[model samples]
Target: MDPNEVPDDDAATSGGALPRRAPGPPRPAPIAEIDALSGDPSFMTSLARGLAVIRAFSERRKSMTIAQISQKTGIPRAAVRRCLFTLAQLGYVHDDNRSFSLLPKVMSLGHAYLSSTPLPVMAQPFLDHVREALHEACSLAILDGDDILYIARSATTTRIMSVDLKIGSRLPAYCTSMGRVLLAAMPQAELDAYLLREELKPLTDRTITSRASLLQALAAVRQNGWAIVDQELELGLRSLAVPIHDTSGTVMGAMNVSVQAARVPVKELETRFLPVLLEASRELSMQLL
Candidate 1:
C-alpha cells in the first residue's frame, strides 16, 4: 500500500495523524520530464530548452544567473546561456552582465494565447455575474498538468487567500475545489495515473493528504456534479466548484466561488451558492457550444 494511505489502526498507534508536509515553492519543469521526447523527430529540443529557461524566472527569482537557471531547469549551463542569448536577442529577456531577467516583450507570448482563446473572454461576464451575485470571488480555470491554472477571475474587495491570485496563477489540483471537479471528470485511467504521481502534501492541517480519502472525495464530486473543498488549500479558505462542459458534453474547465471559511458555512455553499454556480456554468457551457 502507498504511504499516503494510512490505516486507522496505524494512525491510532502513532498517537496522532501523520505530520503534514509543506511543499516548497514551485520550480520550472525539469528537462528530465521531456527526456523521453529527445529521440522523437517531431520534438523541438531547442525551443523546449528556451521555454524551460524562461520558466526558471519567477516572482521571487526575478533575475537569475546561467548556473541558477541551469540548476532550476536541469539544462546544462552552456545550453541555458545559449537560450538566454537567443531570448535576449529576440527582446524576450535582458542580461546585465551577471543575471538575466524577462523583458516586457515576453508579455506578448501570454497575450497571444489569451487573445486567441475564447474561453477567458467569454467567461469574464459570467464570472463577473457570479461574483456580483455571491459577493465572493469567482474564477474560471482549467486543469493544467497537476495544477489548476486560473484564466479569468472576478474578485471582491475582501481578499480571502494569502496569495493574490489572477490570470496565470496556478494551485495544486488535489486539494482545490475546482481541481477536484476537473479531476472527477477525468477518465479512470488518467485519474489513476495522476493519483499515483502527485504528492498529496498538505497545505493545511485540514487538507486531505490521504490518496484513498481524495479518491472518495472525487467520487462524491462525480455523484453530486459539484465539489466543495473546505479549508483544504488554505486554513480559512473554502471553495465550491462545478464543471464547465463543451458542445459534446465534455468537461472543458471548472468555475468556482471562494469564500472565507469563517464567514460562510459549507451548508451555505451547497444550499445557497450551488444553484447559481450550476446555472452560470450551464450558461458558459452553452456559450462554448
Candidate 2:
C-alpha cells in the first residue's frame, strides 16, 4: 500500500515501525543526483562523457569491450577503459575480462528514483486509465533544456506521430504539449533565459515563433492548468496536456494524450480529453508526500 494509503498503525512491522523523518531538505530529490550545474564547460564536458559511457550500453549492446565502447561512444580506448574501471569500482558495472555490462546493483540508481519517488508510482494506473479513456498515446515528460524528455509512456496501437515515441526520446519542448506545462511552472527570469536561448524555429506552420507569443501562451497554460497544440510539433498531430504537481506544488511533470487531427477534433480534445487529464493529475497529486 502507499504511504498515504496507510495510517500510523498500519506502518508498523513485526518488531518496530518505520523510523520517523526529521525535517530534511525542501525537496526530497533522489540520492546520487548531481548538484545544480555550473556554466564551466570542462565540468559539463566530463559529466557528459561519463553519461555517454553509461548510455553506450543499452538493450542491444548489453556487453561491450573497450574497443566496442570506443566505437559506440567515440571515446579513445584508453578513456573507455578508465571509465569502465571507475564504474566497476563504484559497483555500478561488472566485467568478465573480455566484456563489460551493468550489474543489477546499477539498477539502484533508477530504483532510488522509482521507489522513493512518489509521482511515477501514482502515475502508472492513471496512465493506463488515460490511455483507455482517450484511445491514443499518453505520456509523461520532464523538462530537459529546450526539449521535453519522455520518462514514461503508454500508447494505443494506432500511432499518432511518425517519430518513434520511445520513453527517452526528446523533442522541442516549445512545440510539444508537455513542454508548455513545464514552461508555465518556471520563474520569469528562467523563462526569459529559455526563450532567448531556444531558437524560435517553426517545427511546422502551426508552431509558436515569437518570444512574446510564447510567453502569452505560457501565461494561458498557468491560468488554465493545461495546454493543447495542433500540428505544432509534427504534421496532422494534436495533443492535450495537464500539469502534475508534487506535494510541494512544484511541476513534477506534464502528462498528455496525442492523437491524429484527422481522427480527433479540437472540440473533442477540450471536451472529452481534458476531463480525463485533469482527473489523472488530481489522482497523481494525492499520492505525493
Candidate 3:
C-alpha cells in the first residue's frame, strides 16, 4: 500500500485508510499567517497582501498573473506585485519566467489551524466512531466564502475526486452537501450576496453550475434542515450533511458523510445517513457551546 494509503495510527481510516494535496505549481502549501510579522504592526500590510495573494491561488486557478491577482483580490496591481515579490524572496512563493505561484511555505498557515485549533482534535475520535458505525467517510467543514474548507476528515481510502484533498481542503459550497448545510444557516442577505458574487462552476456533469438552480437548492436545504448532494461534487460520491450550531443557535460548522453512489441512493442518504449525521452534528455543536 502507498504511504498515504496506510493508517497513520491504530485509528481506522475511512474505507480503510490515507492523503494531502499540494496547493499547486510553485504553489507552496497555504500558510495563513506570518510568524515574524505578529509582533510588529509594520508587517501588517505586508502580511495582509501576502496572505491575499496566497488565497488567490485555488483549485480553479492554481497559477496567476499579477493582473489576475489584482482582479481577484481587489488590490492594486502594484501592491499585488510587491507582495508576490516579497513572498518569492522569502521562499514563500515562486517566480518562473513570468508566472507566480505559492510554495510549501504556504502550508504553514493551514498547518496553524490544524495545530492550534482544538475543534478538529476533539472531533477526530467522534468522527471515527460515527464513520465506523455508518461505514462511510465523514468530514467536518467550515464556510469560507462560496466554498467549504475540510478542516477534519474521517476519510475513506477511496480516491474519488479528480484532485486529492486532505485536511484544509476547499471545495465550492453550492455543489456539496456540506456547503448547503452551512449555507442554509446563513442569513438571507449574506446568502443572496454570495449567490450574486459567485457564479457556480460545473465540477462534474451533475454539478449545479447555474445560479438560479443553486438558489432553489439552497432554499430547500434551508427548509429541510439538512442537505443531500448526489454526484454534484464528483461522480459516484454521494454525501449527506447537517448544520452544527452553537448554544445560541449560531452555526459553528457542518458535518458530512460521503458514500459510494452505487451503494446508496439519495433517498437512502436522507433515510439512513441523515439521522446519524444529525446526531453527530448536535453533539459537536453542544461541545462547541
Candidate 4:
C-alpha cells in the first residue's frame, strides 16, 4: 500500500473505538503575498497560487472540481482553472473535464528533496535494522511546523495504525512520541511560539490537551533523552522515540518504533524496545558525525 494514500475508511482502527489517524495541522489559507519578496518584481503571485492549487489535493481529497479547489485554496475559480490547465499541460495533473487529479509526476517534487538530502537515505538502513531487531514498525521523521513529517520508514506487515503512513505522512506534534522528542529539542523561544500558535485538539481520551501537561511531557523527554507516547495518537498504538543528532550535536530528526498497545505493553516498550531504539539512534548519529 502506498504510504501517501489515505485509507478509504477514515475512522478505521486496529483495536480501538477511536480513529487511529489523528487530525493533522489545519491547512493554512492561501498566501496573499510573498512577504519576504514584497517589492521584488521577480516574486510571482501567480506561481505561488499555482503551487497552492497543487497542494489543494491531498490524501483525503484525491480529486476535485475547479470549484472545490477554489474553495479549499481560497483562490479565485478562474485562477484555479488556469492553474489546473497549466499543471495539466505540464503533465503534473490529469484533467477528466469535470475534476482534476494529480499524476505520478507530482512525486518528482518530493523526489528532488529526498535525492538531495542524505538524511533519509542514511537513516533507512538503521531503521531497517531496528525494525528487524524489534519486530515493529520503525520510522524517521522531522518536525515540520506543528507536525512531524515522516521522511523514511520500515513498516511491519501487521498494521498498527489505521492510516497509511508513508514517507510524506504528517501527524500532530503534540500527540506523537517522535513529535515529543523533536519538540523537546527545540530552543525555548521556538517551542513557546509553536505552543502559542498551534491549537491542541484531543484525539483520544489519553491525549494531552492542556499546554501545561504537554510542556511537562516535553520537559521529561528533554531530560531523559527519549519519549514514550502510549495510546495518545491512537487508542491501540504506543510508540517510543529518541532524538537523532548530527556532528554538531544538533537534533536532526527522531527515530521511533511503534507497536500495538495490547501486544506490547508500556513496560515491555520501555524495557525491551527503548534500548534498541536508543542504540539505533546512536548509530545513525555517529554516521552523521
In angstroms, what RMSD does candidate 2 have relative to the true structure?
A: 14.2
- Per-residue CA lDDT of model 4 for 72-147, tens digit only, reads 8766676678788999999999999999999999999989999998999999999999999988889999997678
| Stretches > 4 Å off in candidate 4 | 1-43
Best prediction by lDDT: 1
Off by over 4 Å in 1: 1-29
Report the error of model 1 at residue 24, Å: 19
**Residue range 139-229, candidate 3, lDDT tens digits:** 9999986789998888767766677767878888888888998888889899888876566778789999887788889889888988889
Top candidate when judged by TM-score against the true structure:
1
lDDT of each: 0.86, 0.75, 0.76, 0.84
RMSD of 1: 11.5
For residues 121-231, could you state the per-residue lDDT of candidate 1 as single tens digits?
999999999999999989999998899989999989988888888887888999999999999999999999899778899888999999999999999999999999999
Q: What is the TM-score of each candidate against the true structure?
A: 0.85, 0.67, 0.73, 0.84
In model 3, which runs have C-alpha deviations exceeding 4 angstroms? 1-48, 59-80, 95-101, 209-212
Candidate 2 — which residues are off by over 4 angstroms? 1-45, 52-112
Ranked candidates, highest lDDT first = 1, 4, 3, 2
Count of clashing pairs, candidate 3 = 14
